[model samples]
Target: MTTEFSPRLFERDSEIRALGEGLLACALPREAWTHEAHLGACLWLLSERPDIDVDAEIGGIIRRFNESVGGVNDDTQGYHDSITRAYVAGVRLFLSETTATSLVERVNAMLLSDVGRRDWPLRFYSRELLFSVPARRGFVEPDRMPLPVAHK
Candidate 1:
C-alpha cells in the first residue's frame, strides 16, 4: 500500500493559524467605532470555523456583559452597550454578502492607529471573542501570543 499525503490538512491548519493571528492583531486599544469593525473581523474568522458555535458564544458574551453591568447607566455600562451593537453588526455582516478580507484590513488599520485606546476593555473582550473561535477549534498556542489580560 502506498501512503498519500493530503495537502488539505496543511491548508486547513494554515488557514486556522492565519485567523488566529488576525484575532491576536485585533487585540488592541480601540474606540467606539472600532467595536463593529473588530466584531466584523471576528465574524469572518468564526465563519471559517464551523466547529465553533458562533451564536452561542456571542450570546454568552452579551449576556455576561449585560449581567456584569446590570444597566447602561455609566461609562462602563455604555461601553458594554457599544459592544452589543458591535456584536449585532458582526452577525449582520456574517450573514450578508460583504467581503471579510476588506473588513479585516479596515479593522487592522483602525486598531494599529489606536483611534480609541480609552475603551481598552471593550476592545479586549471583542478580541477575546474572536480568539475563542480558534481556541475552540484547537488552534491556539499559548506561546504564540499571550492571552488578553482579564478586565476587572
Candidate 2:
C-alpha cells in the first residue's frame, strides 16, 4: 500500500494492487492469504483506492473473501472485525505522517514499524477482549488504550 512494506514479500505497487484485486474478486488462494497479504490489500485499499469507503466496506469485503475461501465467519473463526478496523486506524495514522512517495516503499516501511507486527493491536486491546467473539464479529473499543484515530 505505502511503498513496499516488506522487500521479501512485495517488490512493487502493482504487486500490492494485484493482491487487492485478487482479494476483491475472491480469486486469491487460501494459502496466499497470509498476514502480510491482508495488510497489503488493506494498504492498497486505504492508500490507492480512495473510491472505497474502507471503514464501511472492509467487513463485507472480508466476509466475501472468507466465504470464497471456504472459511466460516462464525463465533470462533474468520472475518475479525475489530482487528480489521483497528489496523485500518493504525494504517491511517501511519500514512498521515508518512514520508515515502511510493506505495511499495511505504508498505515496506510500515512492515518494519511496530504496526506491522501481528500483535500490534495488543498494545491497545487486552488479549481477552481483542480475541473475543464480539470482537471477531464487530468493532470493539480498546480496553487498554484509545486508538490514535479515535482520539479525534
Candidate 3:
C-alpha cells in the first residue's frame, strides 16, 4: 500500500484535469473511453498503487471485453487496436521516461501475447473505474489538495 510519486506524473495535471472534465461533461450519458481519459485513469492508479500488476489487470479488462462484446470483427478490431495504442500512449505521456518505457514495453509485450488479444465492449470501463472504484475504496484522487483556510 505504499504510494509512488513522480514529478512527471504531476506535470500532466492539466491533461488529467481536462480529461476528468470531459468525463464530467459526458456524465449524463455514458462516456466512451478515450486515450486521454484512460491515460489519466492509469496515471491515477499508478500514483496511488504502483505495486499493481498492470499486465494482469489489463488482461482481465481484455477478458471482460471479450465476454461483453463476443467476437471481434471488422467493426470492432479498430477499437481493440485503439485501446492498445492508448494504453501505451498513456504510459508514455504520464510517467517518467524510464518508467514509461518499461511499462510501454511490458504492455506491448502483453498485447503481443495471447491474453492481451481482447478489448473492452465500451470505452467507459476506464471512466467507470476512475470515477467509481477509488471513491468506494476510500482512495483520494491524486493531485487533489485540500483548499487553504481563508483568513478574515
Candidate 4:
C-alpha cells in the first residue's frame, strides 16, 4: 500500500481510453496499475463504455486482471472491496460534478484535487478500519466519515 504515486495519471484522452481498454482486456502492465490509472479506468468505462456496468462489474474485472498479471486476490493482497468501491463511487461522483470536455482533463483535475492523494480513503475511513481484513474481504461501513457518494 506504500507504492509510489504520481499526481498525474494520463497526458491525453487516449491514455485514459487505453487504460480502460487494457483493464477490460487484462493487458494493462503491472506497473501501470497505479492509483491514478485505477481512477482513470473508471472514467473511461463510465464515460465511454456504457455497455459495461462499471460498479457492478469492477470487482470481477479487477480480480481477473490481477490474476492475469500474476497477482493474488486474497484478503491482504490484490483487491480490497471497500476501497475499490469507494474509489469507483468517487470517480462516478466526480464525473457527475465536472464538465470537462475530455477524460484526461477530468483525471488531471482529480489528480490536482484531494482525491489525488494516495491516502484519499483516510478521509472517510480510519486507517485501522480501511486496511482491516473485513474491509479487504468485502465492503464495510466507514468508521470515520461518510463517503460523498451514497453507497450500499
Candidate 5:
C-alpha cells in the first residue's frame, strides 16, 4: 500500500484495536458486546462531521461499555478477537453498497503496483468471494482464480 492508502487502513485498524484494549481493561460482562459499540465506532468513522477525537472517543466508549457490565479478560487474546470481528463487520456493512467491479479494479491496481516493489512479499491477503458477479471481459477471469472449498 502507498503511504496515502495505508494510513486510511491503519487508522481504521488502530481505532478498533484501541477500543478492544479499553474493553479488556474495564470490568464488563458479555452484555457489553450487545451495546452497539461497534456500530457507534463505524458511524463515527463514516460520519459527515467527525467532531470527536478518534482514539479518545473509542477508548472512552469501550471503557464505559465495559463498566456497564462485569469485567472480563483484560488481555491480548480477548481484545484481538473482539477487535477483529468488529472490524470485519464494520467493513462489510460500510462497503456493502460499493460495486464489486470497483472493488476488483482498485484491488487489482493496488496489487499490480505493489507487486513491482521490493516490499512485495511482505504483503499478502486472500478473500473468498461469497457472491458471484457477472464476468466482464478485460476485467478478471474467474477461471484464473481458485474457488473456495465448499463448506459442509
Candidate 6:
C-alpha cells in the first residue's frame, strides 16, 4: 500500500495533536489510550476513508498563514518516518495555541459524533499504544488543591 505524503496531511496531524493536547490539559484521563493508540486513531481516520488516498488526504485543515510559512517542523520529517511520535508532538503544538476548556468541548463532540464511533482496528488503538507517549507532561501539578488555612 502506498502512503501519500502531502503538506495538508502534516498540517492536519499538527491540528489533531494540538486539539488532543489542549483537551488533555484540562481533564483528559491521565491514562486512557497509549501514545500509539492516539496515533492509531488518527491513522485509521486517514486510511478508513477508501475514496480518499491515505497519502494524499489532508491530515488537517490548512490555514492561511501556514501556506507562506511552509514546513511545520524543521527537525521532524514527514508523517511516514515517525507517525506516532510526530502526532504526539502535534499535541503539544496544539496545547500551546489553544485553551483547555474549548479543547475538552471539541473532544467530547468528536467522541460523540458518528465518525468517532465507527469501527476501526484496535490493535494499535488499545492500551498497548500508551507506551508510545509519555506518562506525565512535565511537572504533573494537581488541577486543584484545598484552600490554605487562614492566619489568625
Top candidate on lDDT is 2
Q: After best superposition, candidate 5 residue 114: deviation in angstroms?
A: 22
Model 5 backbone overlap count = 6
lDDT of 3 by residue, 5-88 (tens): 221222344545454344333331124344334555454445434565554454344334434444342332422433443454
lDDT of 6 by residue, 17-73 (tens): 553443323233424333333543444333233464433333332111122234342
- What are the models' TM-scores? 0.29, 0.91, 0.32, 0.90, 0.29, 0.21
Q: Is candidate 2 or 5 superior in TM-score?
A: 2
Q: Count steric clashes of candidate 6.
A: 9
Candidate 1 global TM-score: 0.29
User: How high is the CA lDDT of each candidate model?
Assistant: 0.39, 0.87, 0.38, 0.84, 0.35, 0.32
lDDT of prediction 3: 0.38
Which residue pairs of candidate 6 clash? 4-55, 9-59, 12-59, 12-60, 17-91, 18-94, 34-129, 34-130, 35-130
lDDT of 2 by residue, 46-137 (tens): 88899999999999998999999999999999899999988998888878877888989888777778778788898899999999999998
Kindly report which residue stretches of model 1 are placed more than 4 angstroms away from their true locations once superposed.
1-37, 59-86, 89-91, 99-152
Model 4, residue 129: distance off in Å is 0.9
What lDDT would candidate 4 get against the real structure?
0.84
TM-score of 5: 0.29
- Which scores better on lDDT, 1 or 3? 1
Which whole-number lDDT from 0 to 100 does residue 127 have in model 4? Answer: 91
Better of 1 and 6 by lDDT: 1
TM-score of 2: 0.91
